[model samples]
Target: MKTRLSLFALLAAATLAGMTSPSALAWNTLNGQKPIVIAHRGASGYLPEHTLAAYTLAIQQGANFIEPDLVLTKDGQFIARHEPMLGGTTDVASRPEFAGYKTTKVVDGVATTDWFASDFTLAEIKQLRAIQPRANRDQSHNGLYEIPTLDEVITLAKTHGVGIYPETKHPTFHQGLGLAMEDALVARLHAAYGNDRDAPVFIQSFESANLRYLNTITNLKLVQLIDADDVNPDGSMSLVDPYRQPYDFIVAGDPRTFADLLTADGLAFIAGYADGVGPWKPYLVKTVADGVDRTGDGHLTINDRRVDGSTGVIEAAHAAGLEIHTWTFRNDASGYGFADPQAEMEYYFNLGVDGVFTDFPDTGVAALAAVPEPGTYALMLAGLGLVGAMARRRKA
Candidate 1:
C-alpha cells in the first residue's frame, strides 16, 4: 500500500534529488552507481535457479549482476547451486547413475539425505538438469537446463558485460572434504581478470574465515552474507536455531552470531577484510506485528504486515565505509514479508542502500527506472515523442 505513487511521480522526485547526475552519486565498491539490482540466481523466479538460461534471462532484463552460489564437485570443479544437496534443485534422484550418491551427510551440522555435489564428478553433474526448487514457482522448465559451472557463469557475465556475485556456499564444510574453495576461486578469477579491483565481481561468503582468507589473496571486493536465524532476539548466538552460528564460528568454538558482525565495532572489523555486507532484508527494515486475523473460514491471515522502515543497518554500514547489499527480493505477494516487492524495494532505496539481490530482475529494473535519476526522464520523454511521431507517420 505504501508504493501508491505513480512511476512518473517517482521519477520526478528522483530528478529533483539530482540522482540523474553521475557526479551526485558516490561509487560503490563494484565501481557502479548506487541502487544496483543483482539478479538473485539469475531471474530465478522465472526459471530454474543457477542455470545458464536463468543468467542470460537476467542479463536481458537489465540486471547489473547475476548471483551464483558456488559448490564444488568431487573433482574440485566449482558449480553454481543453491546448496550442495542436489535433490531439490536438480533432477538427480531420477538419474539412476547418481542413485548411489543419495546418502545422508551432515552439512553445516544438519543431516541431509540427498545427492550431494561433492559425491559426483562434474561429468556426472552434467547428466542432471536443474529443476525449480520452490513448489510455488513454475516447474515446466525443469529438466530443460543443465546446472552451470562457475567458469561458465563467469564467461556469461563477461560476454554480456554483467557482474558476478559468487557466494562460497558452506566453505568450512567444503574445506573439511579436502576442497578449499577460496584458492580455487582466486585462481579462476586471477586467470580471467588479474587482481582488478573493479572487475565487476564480488566474492561473498557466510563464514568469516574464508572471506578473511580470500581477502588476503584477492584484491577483488568481498561481501559478508548474514543470516537472520543466526542470532536471537536478545542479540545472542542461537546455536539451537537451525541456521544460527556460522560453521567457522562453531569450528573455532566462537559463540558469536551474525548479529555480532553487524555491530559498529563488528562492521569496522569487517571493513578491514571485506568491502560490503549482504544481509537478509529484515536487518534493514523489519515487519511489525499489528494483529492476527480470525476469519469465518478456517484460513488465517496476518492483519498487518507493514514494514517499519530504516533499521539503521544501512547507515551503520555506510558509516563504517561498508556497502549494504540486501538479499532475496521476490515479486511475490507473500514471501518478502512486505505488502509488495515495489514497496519493499522503495523502502530500501529510500534508506540509501547500495544494492539489492532480487529473484525478479525485471521488477528490480522497473522499480529503479520508476525512480529515475535526473536525465532519465528527459530520455523517456524523447523516446515517447519518437514513438508518437512513428505512429503518426505510419497512419499517413
Candidate 2:
C-alpha cells in the first residue's frame, strides 16, 4: 500500500505541474528538448499490442509518438507485427481454418515454428484478431482488435498529429522472401510525409547495411537499434550466438558484436548513417545484481539490483552527434534497478536519454513530467535513496 501510494503521489504531482506550467528544466538531451515518449507497441500494457485501439489509447494518454514493428504480408503490403511470425500475437493458434498454414522457418538464424505473416494475404489476416502475447498482461482485450496495415497506421498517426517510429522487422529475411522493405517503406513514407528529413518518422532497424542503404534513398530520420542477449551479474552485457551480432552482420562478416556498436568508433560509424541510436536499456545504465535485494523482495530480481548510474553510452552517443533512445519500459515488467517503474524511467530521463519506448505511455508521460528541475535534482536523488533505505529497513 505504501509503495502504491508513493507512486500515485508522484504521478499526481507530475500531471498537475505538467498541466500548469511550461517546462523550463534544463535537459542533457542531444537537442536540449524534452525527451519524447514513444508508445512501444501502442499502450501495449493495457491492450493487445499493434491494434488501432492500443495506438489510439496511447495518443489519448499523451504519448508523443507511436511505434509499429512492420512485417510484410503475402501480397507484399506492410502490416504491423512485432515479428514476421504471427502465431504468438494473434488468434491464429486457435483458428482451425489456418492450421495448415503453420510451418517452421528460420528467422535471423533461429528456426521458428509458427504461422508467418508472409504466408497470409491481407484479407486472410483480417480474419484474425490481435492477442496479448505476454500472458501476464490483460487478456480480455484479445479477439477484439484487428491487425492494421502500415498505411492505416500512418493515417492514424497523421490524423492525431503524433509521430510514428516504425521498425522494419528482419529486413534481410523479408528481402529473402522477395519482399524487400526499404523501397516500399521509403515510397510509402515519402507519400505520407514527403522527402523531408524533418518528417515525424524515425525508421529503425538492427541491421547496419539496411540502415546505410536507407540513408542513401530517404532523407527521413533513421535510428540504428543495438541489441544484446542479456546483462551479466557484474553489469556487463552478455553477447551470445544470434543475439550477439546483427543477423546481417553474420552474413556480411562484419564481425562486430552489438556492444562494439556502442563504442566511440562504432557510434561514429552509426552517426554517419543514422540520426539516432536505440539501444536496449541495459546498454545505457549500470545495474548490478550484487545480492543486496535493495527492494526487500524476499528473492532478488532485476528490480532489486543496485543502480550504479549511467554507463556513459548516452553521453557517448550525444558526443557522436546522435540522439540516444533506450527502450521497452513496462509498468508490469522490467523496472531494472527500481521497484517503481515510473522512477526507473525518471532515472533514465535524469541521465539524459532523448526518448523512451514504453508499453505504458501514461506512465512514461508521467515519468517525464516528474523529472526534476536542475535545482531539484539532489532532492529527487535523496528521495530515491530514502525509498531504498525504507525497503531495506522493512526487510530487516
Candidate 3:
C-alpha cells in the first residue's frame, strides 16, 4: 500500500486481471504436503522468461512462489531478468539502437560479449520486446511481451494471491554500481507486503554475501545457492574441507567453493545466517552402479555405499534447523529441469525438502496434493464443506 503506484493506477491494472485472488497462501494452508513448488522465472518453459504473461500463467498453474531474477536498470529501477544480457531473453540483438550496448568484459571468470541491461536505460529496454531464446524450445511466445519492473511484478503477484521469490542476480556487481541492490529490493518488498518473516515469499541468491546482508536488513526468509564439484572423488572430504580452518566465507570477495559449506563446521556457520540451503541437484542424490563409479551430464551420482559419502551435508544442514531444497528443476530434454515433475517432487518430499525450484508450479502442486493419504483428503473435504456451509449462512 506504501508503493509509489497510485490508487487509480493499481485499480486500472487490477481491472486487467478480471478476477482478484486471495492473499498469500499460508503454509499451514498446505495441509501437510511436499515442498512448495516455485516457478523458475515464472513458467519460463512455456513463455518468455520474466514476462508478466509468464508470471500470470504460472500463478494460475498453482505455483506457490513465482520466481523473478532481479536486475537493475540504469535509471535504478529493478526488472525481472535472468541475466543482464538482453541477447538471450529479449530482441536486443535485432535492434540497432541497442547494438552499442553490446559489450562484455568477464562474468564469473568467463569472458563473453552481449547486450547489457545496465547500459540500457529503462526507456531503451521498453523499446525491445521479449522472445523465446532457445530454438529447440517453444518460440511461439516470440515478441509477445515486454520486460516488467519489480514494482509491476510485486503488484501482479499480490493481485493474484501469489508469492514471489526474487534472486539478487550478481549482487557483488550491482553493489559496485552504488545501487545497494539488496537494500533497494527489500525496502520495496516490505513497503508492499508488510514484512511477515514467513510471508510466503523467499528472497534468494547464488552469492552468500547478499543473503548475509539481507539477514541484517529485514525479517524475510533468505536462501543460499550451492553448486556441484566436478572433480571431487570423495564427497565427504569435499564437503568437510570448507570448515577445517578460518576459510573464505562469502561467494563475494572471498569466492569460497561448495566444499566449504558442506563440512560440519561450514554448515554450523551458515545456519547462523540462513533459513535454508538451495543446493544443485547433483549434490543431493548421486546415481551409482556396480564397482566403478560413473559420472556425466544430466545428473550427478553420489552413492555413499561405495563412495562412503553420507548425504550428511543435508543432514548437517537439517540438524542445524535448515531446509535443504535443491534447485533449477526444469522440464527440458537437457535434464536440467525435472523430467517427471511428480516423481521429482516425491523424491524431494521424501528427502524432507522444505521447498523446490521448478519451472512449472502446476505440476508440482498436483504432486504435493497427491502425497497426502486418503484420510487427509477426507479431513480436507469435511473442512471445505463446513466452510461452504458457513459462507452460505453468512450470506443468508
- Top candidate (TM-score): 2
Query: Can you write out model 1's per-residue Cα lDDT over 1-396, one digit (the tens) per residue?
Result: 223223444555565566676433443223345578999999999999999999999999999999999999999999999898899999887888767778988888888888899999999899889999889899999999998998999899999999999999999889889988998899998887789888889999889999999999999999998886632333233445445656898889988777778889888978999999988776777545444332234433432444566677888898898888988788764232455677667667766788989999998888776664634455564455555555556766
Please give me the total number of clashing residue pairs in predicted model 1: 2
The ten-residue window of minimal lDDT in model 2 covers: 16-25
Q: Which pairs of residues clash in candidate 3, taking residues 3 or more apart in a chain or in different chains?
A: 239-263, 242-260, 286-301, 286-302, 287-301, 330-337, 330-338
Which one is best on lDDT? 2
lDDT of each: 0.80, 0.89, 0.69
* Model 2 alpha-carbon miss at residue 93, Å: 1.5
Q: What's each prediction's TM-score?
A: 0.83, 0.87, 0.75
What does candidate 3's lDDT look like per residue over 210-322, in tens digits?
A: 78888998888887777653425333334433322112243335645675676777677678888777876656654333343332344444332232223555666777777
Q: Tens-digit lDDT track for model 2 on 1-396?
A: 566646645644564455323333357789878899999989999999999999999999999999999999999999999999998899999999999999998998889999999999999999999999998888998999999999999999999999999999999998888999999999999999999998899999988899999999999999999998877756678899878988899998889999999999999999999999999998988877788877676887666788888999999999999999999898887656777899989999989999999999999999998986542543454466567557656876
Worst 10 residues of 3 by lDDT: 22-31
Off by over 4 Å in 2: 1-25, 288-291, 297-303, 373-396
Give residue 264's error in model 3 in angstroms: 2.3
